[model samples]
Target: MSGLIGRLRGRGRPPFAALAAGLGLAALSLSACGGGDAPPANVVATGSAPSYYPADYAQVINASKGEGGTLTIYSNTDQENWAPIFHDFQKKYPWVKKISANNLDSDEVFQRVLSEQATSGSPADLLVSNAAQAWAEFAAKPNALMAYKSPELAKLPKFAQLLPNVYAMSVDPLSAVYNKTLIDQQPDTLQGLADLVAKDQGKYRDKITTRDVKGSFGFTVSHAFTSARPGSWAALQKILPLARPETSSGTQLEKITSGEYVAGFFISAAPAYPVAAKSGGLLKITFLKDGTVVLPRGVGIAAKAPHPATSKLFADFLMSQEGQRAVAEGGLTSYRGDVETRKDRHTYQELVSKVGESNVIFARYAEVPGAEVNAFVSRWNGLLGH
Candidate 1:
């Protein structure tokens, strides 16, 4: 997909000569439409600052224009989810020639930044990830991130400000998914699911799925969900015995889709929502009625950012109304309440409305005590009979 987008940027062409004939008409259409050589006339360019913008916001834009180069980012999300954002950002800030957005694991995003900066310095200007533990660990290092407080910060929810530097890029709720055809009694909560399975362990034994809880994402969501309430561990005792643990959300969703697994809990909705959208009634998803864990993907500028001014501009742009709407268009849940609601996209406001404000558990950016984490993982493993 990144390669496809690169081709769209006119940086390169498709490798196969055989494809030229088929692509010729599309090329003609692109040329006819000016091929995005400039932003549309209606676009309020970044130079035209809004009233809410900081007095010095114009200086940042001018500085970025002076930099006049690619704004490199290391992110945990796929390029498909970033394409719309990059397109919209470029439209607003035309001087930014390109955005090199690389998709990597949440932990790897920090790893690359740390390892590179240790040597010749990283080219990455921005970093985005939802792995809470990795984030806490990274921020513990000296000069781990740039401590620029965005003017848009005041507009965001307090929890969005994960640290002095890091902030939430998107708020994604963990969802429970099932093969509706295979399970007639769909459960809305973990406790309910446990009760349903307990009625007939023969049918559900080894059929339920959840995260492995060793990896960063799995641990963050699992720990948040369980620690949110008193009875969660009790519910897990019933469910985990019959569950198979997987490392990736995509795998869990696939198994559920194929009926290899009857249901999966603690699955990231970033991937699940899109799959459920096109499942044609085979898949169904619901937030846990007891407690829904909302994981915030953190975004921060690198301390040694190659394009500091451009990174700052991009960070502020992400918190703007237009940028939030574009984020929703990219299939990410926007947290800002001002954005208009759509049936296809979920938002933090909608999650609160459905699950209630009190039941929404946010995975915090603070580090968990090492002893507590070790004990939790040990108990979790024991539940799996490991």
Candidate 2:
């Protein structure tokens, strides 16, 4: 839910770089390598389709080939984070000529679709975001999202399906990120961090940062953390006063890396882990011991998609085994059990195993009761002294 995390210049090897090298850009020059089994220029290779695919899946693929082979998406994710998955999608469906993903605020993903659809018709074939409440609101709107049940739907956890059509793009955990040079003692839980700050009040004051709960992502993560453990409020009360509330994950990570801020909590792991992997021992992160909140980024096709057939193909691809692997490679946490765990790259399966199922707090798709949301935000602002 890092709504404002734009192009990142991480020091590590670009995600999926190896895969891209091995695959080469053969799709662009398919005719150069003559293969007897190759599908026609416009159609996908039916023989290569997964066995789990629907019987009529070939029809969907062929239909997409005739429908202009382009897709437009409204999402909160940066293109760099999506490059691996996009690369794989294009490689699989060589006919797809363009993929336009506009990065926006989580809530804006829905707003843009709704606004455009009501007027000149939204160009969005798909929409992706982590704003749970906004997704709930959009679902309430008639014909907002197409009800396309993917073949991979049954393979995913029930919770992965946010609504009839919306699905979790990635299941990411909220974690605490700290600068190794700034703090001698590393705490694994929010309460421990609070205790550490209280021990040296003067040194820690204004040195901790977190998401501002006024925004959707910030509010969702914080609310889930607090709700999962009521006693966490005691810890937050001590921490928030001495902390600065940031509107973006990128800024929090940047300031922490530069030592301007010593630590940050309820930070998104999707972006944090990849950056930490290449921080040269400067940045470190820990899943909260008391309760780790798992936020699932949601994706779905638009009801009035300009490229519905292509959108359907892309949606199915996202939930497939290969797609999930690309998702993890691209730095987003994959939830599929089959996706193997790698250094710095996390999967929801590993998170559940690490934290114990009880401590893995899932941020559900439903809107938090309006009255409850208002109360939570009010108290959160109070603790921040805002």
Candidate 3:
């Protein structure tokens, strides 16, 4: 394990402490979308777990167990959120002696993984990131990520499934979180927020908050909205001036609860849900009626992963019913229709039902062209004066 770590920790790599701090900030911001309710204790699997795997699921597991090795993963997911999933995976596959996991910023993960791949060293066996654009851009390189179509993909919503190599593990929808005490009237749609900002410009000035589009995760989301939603750029331009831009959703939520900011837009439901649920109704999350952008946590396997069999097994496990439930329990948005949670929250199906299928924009990074992304980023930088 030390040898593998040393090999990957080559020249030009930032210290783990620095990576953690950066990732901690990004994770705190991204995880701000969490739900308030605790996941049910006895989450019943939709069906037999083995059934979700391919016909040779047992063979894959057996092979992985036979060829024992450490499985290293590079991810941006919070440790608390991923602990349950990792625990379950270990319990299921005891043959794998150790699992080395590192939490880093999405950009750092991309760079480190790319460097490791280039050296033909022990790169990450598995890669998980919220930055969809990074994964999409990586997919363009031949053999950058392994291509495996899990049987569980058939069970996921069409929107959750990305390229054959990349799969959406968690579906975090962007919503509006407001301080109920400060804002008497809640806007049901983005347009409504725009109107409020325009009509009562003085009242809402410096009262709204959102991700900094210039930042990594923020750019991915803002860019997607630009490409997917018509006139969204115009809406953003009208609304951002009223918003106090911040990179961390935790910061946004804190200020909103403190009455420093009346509302926050484009907030992930993952972190916001739990905070609002526990806020004694002081904080509330609302899915925009016009449309809600679902930011999926993209999971993929490195093409040159050392523990290929184990990587495949783990990836397949993540997409299983049990894994999806763990994802929801971990406070992420579950994309599986079979999974259900507390009444206060909207299941994947409920979200689609309430918002209408057309209004739910799944940010498929693979589908977005690079030129469009550059244009959007340039415009966003100009608008934000970054």
The residue pairs in collision within model 1 are none
- Please give the TM-score that candidate 3 achieves against the real structure: 0.82
lDDT of each: 0.76, 0.76, 0.69
lDDT of 3 by residue, 16-115 (tens): 2344545433222111323233433433332123744556666766677666556878876666566566555555554555666666766556778778
Q: For all candidates, what are the clash counts? A: 0, 0, 15
Q: TM-score for all predictions?
A: 0.89, 0.87, 0.82
Q: Which is better, 1 or 3, measured by TM-score? A: 1
Question: Which portions of model 2 show Cα errors greater than 4 Å?
Answer: 1-48
lDDT of 1 by residue, 1-386 (tens): 11111111110111122243223211112223233576644346645555788787788888888886578887766655666667667777767767776556567677778779879988888998887767777876789898898888778788878877988888888889999999969999888998998899889888999887766677777888777786788888988888988877888888899989999998888788888989998999899989999988889998988899999988987877777776777778899888776886668988888889998999888677756676777888788732
Model 2: lDDT to the true structure:
0.76
Report lDDT (Cα) of residue 141, candidate 2. 74
Q: Judged by TM-score relative to the true structure, which candidate is superior, 1 or 2?
A: 1
Per-model RMSD to reference: 7.7, 6.8, 7.2
